[model samples]
Target: MRVTRRRPEWRVTAIARDTYALEQKSPYAQCVDYLLVGRDRAAVIDTGLASRGALRSVVTALTDRPVDVWLTHGHADHIGHAGEFGAAYLHEADRPVQAAHSDPAFLKRLLREEMGAALAAVARPVVRRVTAIPPADYRWFGDDQVFDLGGREVTVVPVPGHTPGSVCYLDQATGGLFTGDSCCDWGVLLHLEFCLPPAVYLESARRLLGLQRAGAFRFNWPGHHGFPAAADLPEQYAACAESIADGSGVVRPRRHHAVVRYRDVLITLPRTYLAQPVGRR
Candidate 1:
């Protein structure tokens, strides 16, 4: 679908006491970026495929505190407006994708290949609008790194499945976990070149499950669709992974890729990974 200029602009919804979700309704992808406000500074998670000025304007209207942008992964939709923010951070594993996506030529190829040529033609303008800001210099952060936003602290947990550097941020004060596409209620996309195997993703799912069991996080906030995923989402994703490992899931073809359905989650991956030994990363 073509992105029209008449579509709704960036909108912000308060998700928690100090957390807000910025929903950008783009024809290419309806993405939700987040802002966690704190006493001293604020943290922004994921910059959607919106115009850099629009994202910056919405963020500035939300908080006056100093803001830091933390990317969930290196996807084009997630990092389009990243250059608008200062103190941006991303994982080293995603640097290659991030760097590649910053180029307009690479982005054009991605849109044509993944989203289809027809959609790519319509989305070219939107892509240009979002990419107006040059790629920002990103500092790297690893797993278990804690970002102290005054009284609130968000811990970064590495969950590399959707992409090599996919991560979830756990809010220590609110018991809310921001899972960026690693596990979403809608579905998980593991068919990309940078995506990890289902077995490797299963391990990460188990890690999130362990955190839930230990009361580290009470709720999950995914990067897309709605907020506060079902409590059993982690379990459901884990079961899906298990089914993929056991060769019990029914596979179906979509576009040019194959997807395996298990429980409420749909996993898209290469058939080669499914044929490999289970639990192999």
Candidate 2:
């Protein structure tokens, strides 16, 4: 995993966590951590792979400002190791989803059936090493909520699509945007969670674009695909929506052709991943 540093005292570290597939193959999504340095307190946005302790070690390296863990969404890849932190915060709307994710058995089943058995192996350590973070400790973030972290103020921008209650953190001090999973591969593929329809997801993407237009932010960092330095994300999203509306986005071999019609806009398993088995299941 490569660790890249951002401008103005913020560093983004990509972890080496891989998920197992049903065919027992390993696939990596390049999870990221956004570490912010403030005069009073420091904050970490999104903890990567719980079992690996990536988030924990990163905090230890930075200043001991009262660390707060902020979740872009409650997807296992983003918040799987949330319990490891003293207290974490996420959008209140995703509370139920987070609750479901905290369940070991459910996660096990999810990996075994949906994701793949190979991923289950990697997930096991994360599940077993689970440290339960209290629900009360987590505060619900609203749209345009600003957290005053001493010298730095990280603004919470709600971009729900990939998941309900998904959020992104904007650091005004650095003009850096922490995009959960909304912008990937240069805003090509926008993955929608089951809770959100494809159309709704497009709307959320537009909201983020508006923020960028306002000129408060410039850089884009996602939960899985690392960082993107583009200013035309709004345009990309519009194109994605257009492909969905039209019939040009579909590809062969995959079943959800209509939903993921745009080759550039859909987030699907890479050929390297789908071709390989997840494990010895």
Candidate 3:
């Protein structure tokens, strides 16, 4: 169901007027990248794994316009194939995270801890292929930075929590917020060493909820696992982060980590972090 004879590597869906969803298929890794096409040029949200083949060709296949890559965050899965591109932008805060996650051995071991050892071993080849290092000299952009793709424009909303530089891109034309690895239906990962405090994520969640309520964007386009996230997903996560911040959230074990789950949404964090006061943390 993931593929057909015509397209083997990706499943393309026109999620918005000029926006397309390029999803990697075959094993269905669920890594989704968004391509926004404009009259003069194009903007790609993230480059997916190299195992799917050259991402530049994929974007060109959709639009022949000149393209610039914008990263939602610097995590390994989201920043895939950045080195192959001519121009890629990332937040300065996640510079360390980008360097650390670029190592294949480190990523392999971390994958083993996150996904079982057997699965990690199975995915080793793809992981190795995906360890394409992003450019060290990146054009850094902070919150409120806008990338103008001719008629289309994407504004960066700094929602740093999953990573210090994590962000969501808002497409002004379509009201589609491309949430790259921030809080999603699956989870928000603040348990990692490089992640910011849970309180930071809580504030971000509240802000995103406010934006949604204020009709800043109609829906959330998640980075992984699913396509369009539920309308209330941000609200649910805001509640979850609030509970975790106030020390009222429930914690349970998952494989090798602990998470505060709200229905299907998960916020992974450590006990030490959970114990700290919101302000101190």
Q: Pick the candidate with the highest lDDT.
A: 1
Candidate that beats the other on TM-score, 1 or 3, i.e. the better one: 1
lDDT of 2 by residue, 37-131 (tens): 67877666776544433445546665566777788878766775565566788988888767767778767776665556546676666566444
Superposition error at 223 for model 2 (Å): 1.3
Instruction: Report the error of model 1 at residue 168, Å.
Output: 0.2
lDDT ranking, best first: 1, 3, 2
Alpha-carbon RMSD, each predicted model: 3.4, 9.6, 3.2
List candidate 2 segments past 4 Å from native. Answer: 1-29, 52-54, 117-120, 131-136, 186-194, 229-234, 245-263, 267-281
* Candidate 3 structure lDDT: 0.79
Q: What TM value does model 3 have?
A: 0.90
Give one digit per residue, the lDDT tens place, for model 3 in 98-203.
7777777777777777778557655677565765444433678777688888878788889989999998998889999999888567788888868787888989
Q: Between the candidate structures 1 and 3, which one is better when assessed by lDDT? A: 1
lDDT of each: 0.81, 0.59, 0.79
